[model samples]
Target: MCIIFLTSLLLSPARTHNLEEIISDCGTKLQTFSIVQMNYDYMFVYVNGEKMGLLEDGRLALYQRFPVGSVLYDPCELPPREVPILTDAAEYGVTACKLIPYGHYEAYIPEPTTGDLHPMTGENVCVYVTNLPPNTTAEMLGRYFEAFDMVAEADVFTAPSGECTGRGWVVFQDPSKLLMVPPVLEFFPRLFIYTSLSDKIPTRTTLQLSSVPEILVPGTDIASFAEPALNHNRSGNHRRMNGKASGNFLKISNAANAGVINASAYYFVALIRRDEVEKSVEEGVFWTNPANRRAFYATLERGPVIIIFLLQEYPVIFGYARLLPDGNADKNGFSACTVEWMKHHVFLKEQDMRNIPSVPISKMGDGVPLKPEIGESICQLAEQHPSHSTILERLGQSSPNNGRHVGRGAGVVISGNGNLGGFNSVGGGGLVHSVGDRGTLRSGIGITSLPQPLGARPATRGGHIMNNRIPQRRRPYNDNSNTYVGYGGGGGSVPPRKL
Candidate 1:
């Protein structure tokens, strides 16, 4: 019996589920965190069962059933009575974990095992993945895919010349036989899953624009001063397919083709300083408080959100990012937001937000109460600035391969459209291999055979060619931003091929 007045959900959508592990002076424990979305206005919070917990790898672990219990606690009592801890397999989760003041109440939700989710199978089950991190390895990825299902085999993408490419495929085995879950990745990585099978799935390649209300010099309500009234549109046209929040979201892209982010996704302002934002970029992760989920994003729907970095003491807005919702939690359980920062640095100050709020707001997940409104203003300001990609555009940085260079040995087309775009080359086997782009790999001397171009029977290691053809590996979210897909073995690095 959980009677929850789900308020303040406009600026921040109510979390469908959550995961919380608290550590106190009494004893360390793993449990679902019970939280009430704070309402500055009238609020009612009653809980008698488990909470929807968060998955360690940025997905929600929704329980099949609701929480069940009537556990009462005595604040005067030093040691509270023990409650049954819940597992992912458990029908319900427990949110009645003990909390003590003087003791440290740290939060962490350990990553689940392969058995965490039910198994999936098919006749020729293959997964196509792209936008992998720089440090991605065959071994690490083998472990990562185990969460989805049984991996029959993990093969590195090798060019026709035998050089490994950045892109690879994981083949799932027959469900009848026992299979092992690949070990968990050493570090959590957020690579985009283009499709479950290597084959192409229908993707919507156009933007479905909608009008969001103006966040102007809007009036502030004194009665509801506890939380700023959010001003945005709810009449979005949404249709999801192939993991995309398709048909109804704002699809904005930049010239560099860096990456197209969803402008309409839930935006937020975190009370972080200039130094912290830079540190996160350097460390490649942004940490947020999970218990106070205004900051945690691991379980949020996968999409890009506008993020504004506000200084804690100063009214200064320092930086901004098109934060991808594929955020993860650290070993200690702090939520890490994956941010793709904008080049336009903000130095604006809002006088109204100079002083911190007096109301009892979440200090850890605390972004200012008027954060939603502030984010809207920042989005308008950012729209005036450049709109190129920060990370996704890096894929197209490779210099085009063209004439004048001669080679007697076999060449591997691992980058830059895989085009043997040269006519003056000494020997031409026409053996131009690439991860994507049907563009012919032209050559001079010996053009033995032209292997299949990308999007048309991609070559595999063990005589297994992939029919999982995507016309163009379009970003699952934005259909407009398409670049010739190529594999970079190590974050877009091209290696030498043998003669």
Candidate 2:
């Protein structure tokens, strides 16, 4: 009676199901690997060169056993395992294999093959593709269909408009037999289906050579369409189809004067000696550290700030008003704020100088005739400056409300009575000259000088001119003075002078 009870228990469906489950859980799916060893019934299987373990009949089963030198039948084949004494295959996959990755072994999916007429050769064979965007091009489509042996040429289309529609067509000489052509690109997330037979369009889609789709029809004919010129107009403003950024971003034309640096996009930063406000070199670079930022703000609290760069060449000068949050540059700063301030204030200032006459250097009313070429020269000077950071700092100081000026000025001279003028030039405009020493004279008489009239010769030294003192030539005119003259020509040389 005891023996009979044991037999009945082994035959129970639950016991059999449990045994199948153990066998399935012992191994993995797609066992394209080797069985290195076995621990009694549990077998150690190697797949894709990786080793793993599997079980059978509770813990008393081999995963899969194979005779040495036995060849794998399929690309997806696994190392053969010992067949269980049981005859049921369904129980192995359905019950036992459920616990394994991928459940049971499956075949490798190969690129599809197409079998149809070659439009050029009229040959009946499988079609293949080359040079594709991973899986995007039409050749890939044909390669995918070749597996079924019924696909013809795949002709893909691209709209010049770059629209999202999958408006292109794929032609098959005969697709009735070969179904399931892999999808080309799509209209949305899903693949587009080509179900029409009689409506195969003969439009010639331009081939990328690499991505070009094949059209396998009776004739090897192709057509071409002119792609529309790229519409750079992004604002939907057709009126501005060719209109460009006129102020800041436009590339300055050089077809006229070569070697001239246009200063349309440049800015200035001056480190003028605060005391010697007129001369630029006296103003050293604003060295910023945590400590300097504090000093800057402290000075700001007292009164308006002045930043300056004594530049020689750059024509257009731009300024950026950075509303720096206290400690912004000193702490973990977001560069986006810096960039935004640059785009708005500096860029707009450049535009103002370009369009509004009042915003230019002439606005100083030193009577200097502002020349467009001088602006270009200033731009060249800024570009030639030693460091980009130094230039940016100078640019920041020149921002509106900073109360800075960049042109040459009567910086401190030992002989304070030195005359200075004609610092700038514009074509066809009269020279702008600066008046000599004002306020009280060194003689302390407080006598004002005769204001020299325009186009008149410079006044003689110490000569009385119409009740005003003719100031003495305290120092001789030299190239270093603001009065240095330039003749615009190919040589582009400054005129000779002596101290």
Candidate 3:
């Protein structure tokens, strides 16, 4: 009877306990378990018939369910573990592996046939050409790739001394064209091409503007607002069609004039300093005077504002943004509006502003249309000026090809004294001349001196002026007082002289 009772007790099932009870029993002396799989929000462990609980902080709890055929052991009972994954380079002959968070371990395995080790494919369609002739240059490579219409940029690697490194890269404007590049190009002598597609590209810094739906701001018509600014003759056909006006609202010209619209979009080109724009964008707050805000909204009727970066080289269209209606008065006594950045906006903050030039837009005439060619001109200017190259680099715009002159001789110089200075054959001359304190003087051609008094007649070549209208005033000499009279370009001032 005793043997039968012991057999029955041994065959009976073990009682299951909740996680709280298990934690009470184990106390702090619990063994950690490795997670094998997760099913129905429960973590399964490698130990047979055992499941683990998770804490609120995403950590595995000691509470576990142990069923039949399961075995639990302390840390000392486990076998020797393998070395942890290494992130950096290791010593020679040492086995090393990198642990990528949330990545599969098998992804690092090399392909048996190709021996390719990269885990992710590149996004750029750039190809690197190696083993090239020492004389191979970027221009030469660019010409060679001219056969491919999509070739956007080619850069040849050079040493610090500016010598060729026999290696270069070619980038395609369309990333899909990268697949067309062969594994090797044998067209050129001694040239071996290798796939070196980069997964990363330069971040775009230009602002993106989206048109706000007209329904958002009721009773305001963009077309009507633009009608006063449009040239009626140029937009006659656009007005005829639909009789109500349709087609692309922004485009000004069309070949047949059938789709042409005479409505010109009105925008307030606020001349915010680049530093101020950057700070506003960084802080996510844009401030303006209440009067300015009213003018901006009233003129465009809550339309999008075309923000331009007033750079020293040129005015660049940074991006487009709409001012939120919920403007509030800030501590600085200025009305503030929250700015929403468009996609792929450029960084505008904390940049060197000493080189930036401020624009006096108020002096400019109103209803001036923002020309598309202006943006193109700015882009061309950026390529020519080294100081403005950051704009192109940030925008990922390709630099102009070698040996191309970017309007170097096309600049005109006009002096404050109404003197026109012509550049030499290359248009590089400046319009500056030293002036005597008494009157205007002429130096060489296109060079004029300053300090011409108001209402004074023009001076002749011999420095004699014909002042026939006004009678000369005789003044008492003040030599003992050490006072002297000097003439400025606009007027005269009393200059103190040493006794």
TM-score of each: 0.24, 0.17, 0.22
The residue-by-residue lDDT of candidate 2 on 1-499, one tens digit each, is 4345445555667654564554453333213223332222444433222233445422211223221111221124355332223225633221222123212221111112222212111111122222222224343343233232222234444335532133233333232232333333221123333432222233333211111111111112223322211111111222112222111221222312232222111112322223332221222222322322333343343222222232322323333222233444434332111111211112222444443222234222211212232333333333333323233334344342232222333211112233322111121122222221111222332222322212334445445553244434554444444443334332345655554
C-alpha RMSD for every candidate: 29.9, 32.1, 30.2
Candidate 2 residue-wise lDDT at 406: 28
- After superposing candidate 1, which stretches have Cα over 4 Å from the reference? 1-264, 292-295, 325-328, 331-333, 351-365, 368-374, 382-499
- Tell me how many residue pairs clash in candidate 1: 18
Worst 10-residue lDDT window for candidate 3 reads 204-213
lDDT at 297, model 2: 44
Among the numbered candidates, top TM-score falls to: 1
User: Tens digits of per-residue lDDT for model 3 on 270-362?
Assistant: 333344556666655555445444444443432344323322222234433444444444543454555553311332322322233221221
> Model 3, stretches more than 4 Å misplaced?
1-264, 311-320, 329-333, 342-499
TM-score ranking of the models:
1, 3, 2
TM-score of 3: 0.22
lDDT of each: 0.33, 0.28, 0.33
**In candidate 2, how many Å is residue 269 off?**
6.1
